[model samples]
Target: MQPVRRSSRLTRNTISAPETAASSSRKNSRKSSQRRIRCTPPPEDSEPEVESLSEENSSEEEEDMHEEILPKETRYENSRTAFQGLYQEKPDLLRPSKKPLSARFLTQGARERTSTVADAGLLYTVCDSDSFQPSIVREFVANLGDAEPRGDGVAVYVRGSLIEFSPSLINTMYCIPHCEEDSSWMDEKLDKVCTLLSGNRIKRWEDMSSKYLTVTNQVLYKLVCSNWIPTMSYTAMNAERLRFIYMLHLRKGFNFGKVIYNQIMRMAENTETEKKRRIILPTLIQQVILIQRNVPPDNSDEAESDFPKLVVKDKKAGLGSGVDSKEPDLEEDIDQAISFLKGIRSRLKRGEYPIQRKNEDSESG
Candidate 1:
């Protein structure tokens, strides 16, 4: 093989000229791309930003809280508690220094899903329907495990169990003590009932009031010495009107009074039932006394006229029965009436009948 000499610079460049032109053409066709850069405001144009007052993020919830019984708001994020209320509170409502409770993230899931334990203490609205959807009832009763009822609070049915004051009040209705709101409510209802009796809103008011008088309003009377009598101690807006209703139509207009009296009368049918006779007589006397007490002194004459004649016919039926056309003020009459009842109870328990009617019945028999 023949020896070859190395090429000079001119010859080398001539060989690479085609590649160089290709590179130049590619460079000429390529476009330069620029990056976006955000610029901060210059120091002269910048001003301190104002922080709007509102609740901090979830991390702020871990702050110290000393209250043993915190308000229900802490559980706002939990879906269970969120559905329990009517509306959600806005975060802006929280004060600048405070945050919601941290423990709310842990909802009462285990306690609810596994147990049928009763929360009898909670106030619940009695939903009246032939059949309630199971899901609705469950939702209504959920998260109510810690509630307790008081002061004219509502009652309802859940899983076939009575909730609120209803369980204690259903059979023994007279035991329901009156409250301030209860009195005002009753006054409004009574006005409605009066309007109904006058033929105004007759259909709606009659049906409603008939049910109300019987089942809805139980605060008007109580049992004492085994007798049902109107409660005299309840505060009243119009004493005279209350007296009139209780005096002339107590057993007639009032639902429970009629039921109680009918039951009492059934028990008192036999002459040998001295105990019932004693209750009946004392109950009548107490009724008179209550009506008398309710009658304002200025209208004593009207009250005396309004009182049933047969009850006061004996003239010595006790409790100033002889005071004609004006029943005496009975504000301090309960104790006296109670004392009289005790005396009657003693006599009856000893097998003595105070009224001559039982002897007459025995003769007739």
Candidate 2:
């Protein structure tokens, strides 16, 4: 009887142990589920918060980029404005020295190559002192009205009449050919010309020097610096002047009429802003006035004969004169230039210069 009772007790103990284990497992599962609920937020709330953070980060990046770019553009524009103003204040700064640069040094090849320039007349015409009447230039500039929005023209008051000088009118007066192509390509050409002239990538205008140029290029450079696109400093050529030289050198199609008109208008605008009387391309202004007055240039032959000779008997003497001369006066420079260009027109008419032929291979390529 004692042994059977002990066996029954053991079986009951084993059955109770399994039931306790099952109940403890159920309690632990419930606690784990509650902890999970407390730790994790809902998907709808979590996703939006993450998205907002990402958007804020992206916006900050964009702002940073914008900030980096805007000031550089603004500063460049400001510097250009300041530079223009500085040149206006001191017009004589445009010439290299007191002694004028003579066109006699230009080779026949140079003349032929640059003949395509529409405003080449200005270069020659302005050289004649009688043609460059500063008083008339100043008068025209003073009476000039606002420039046309298209930048193709400007209006000036002549003899109490408002005369609009369009590109066509300018062409008629100067005998410049019309060009229809855009000048935007000039920007790309600037880099190419810099590399070609300097034999290295030159970013600053101050860094570009005649020392880096070949003999042929040096002559071309001096010709442009002295006559074509005279600037404030010969040592440091203006980028715009350099670009103009490149255009002339390439003999490419560009709207030179518009360029002349725009430059005149810009000078006028500068005068208005600074309340100062200044003139550039005086011969151009003289032509416009003569056309308005219906008067032809007088004493052409006599004027040519009376012009002083610019023949530099000694090359060293010319150089020494330039170095020793006092501050250059505009009138004196114009007189010298005029004397130098005398009889040039007759020479050109006589076919003394060879015609410039186009480079077919270059064009094709």
Candidate 3:
């Protein structure tokens, strides 16, 4: 009777053949296969398993069907320790091999771009630490007024802080634009960093705790040994600048080598302005000894003199050349010291500079 008067509505609603049953079966199969293909993420209390899918022969249609059956916003996360903000790949999948972590070891143009990302994270970890408990961090979050700037970037100094003398640290954070062809992006990144540093008022490394101090020191050490700045050259810094650097390391119980003295002298000699260089020369020599935690030798006969004892002699115009002249021989002693230094160098080269015996009997006797 129904076949004689079959209506479209009834036909549409009716489960006609075993095809419907088969469809149901297919859906069940997909759910089972998908569950096996991708395991449910482990519960918080449970350890995660690293499992590979065994559905190598699974058809694309079947895969698509499986995807359609799965619900959106699954409560799953990767077992990897990496932060969720960085990667979004499926959990339990095998990661590919990777090269060394060092930028120096990395090949090609990878390092140039990664320099910002990798180092940004490095600096963040540093700047984000809680070591400022003993100090202040300036927070640099944005939109804070009536804030005082405590330090200077152009003339940076650090007291009892090793991170301060890090020229690379300063260079990396400074806002100078990049010189590369694709510097727009790099410059943007640099500008963003520099703004962050400035806005937060982190003019000194002492503003940051020692969270990433190791990396920071290593970077500066490499930069120094390589005779390089990140985006600039190692032109001679003046004595005031060097004193600033020296005091930073000194307070941290750091010592300078004799090479530092030679380098400073070389820079002083290279200065075009003779008077200015002379002024810096004595101060630099004084700082070198002071920072090394060494007492200056007593050169005065009375041992208590107004002049500061250092590598530069304290002899004034009274016992100096051009003493009788009206115009000051502003560089008289300095010039003699320079000449003496040159003589020492020449004698040392020829093995003629020998140690003088203080207790030798007089030639007259």
Question: Which candidate leads the pack in TM-score?
Answer: 2
The residue pairs found clashing in candidate 1 are 121-148, 121-149
Clashes of each: 2, 0, 1
Q: Write the per-residue lDDT of candidate 2 for residues 304-349, one digit (tens) a residue.
A: 1123223222222112112222333569768978977876766766
Better of 2 and 3 by TM-score: 2
| Segments of candidate 1 deviating more than 4 angstroms | 1-132, 146-185, 188-192, 198-365
TM-score of each: 0.15, 0.43, 0.15
- TM-score, candidate 2, is 0.43
Q: Name the best candidate (by lDDT).
A: 2
User: lDDT of candidate 2 vs native?
Assistant: 0.56
Instruction: Compose the digit string of candidate 1's lDDT tens values, residues 1-365.
Output: 75554566668788899999989978855442343445767677365443432244332444534434465666555655665453455554333454433434233433331121112111111111122232322322341333345433333333344344222242233332222221232244544444323223222221222212321121221111122333333322233333333322222222333334344334335424453342232323223223223312332222222222121121211122111222233564678789999998888777687466578778999
Candidate 1 CA-lDDT value? 0.34
Ordered by lDDT, highest first, the candidates read 2, 1, 3
Using TM-score as the measure, what is the rank order of every candidate, best first? Answer: 2, 3, 1
Backbone clashes in model 3, listed as residue pairs:
140-200
TM-score of 3: 0.15
Deviation (Å) of 98 in candidate 1: 71
What's the residue-level lDDT of 325 in candidate 2? Answer: 20
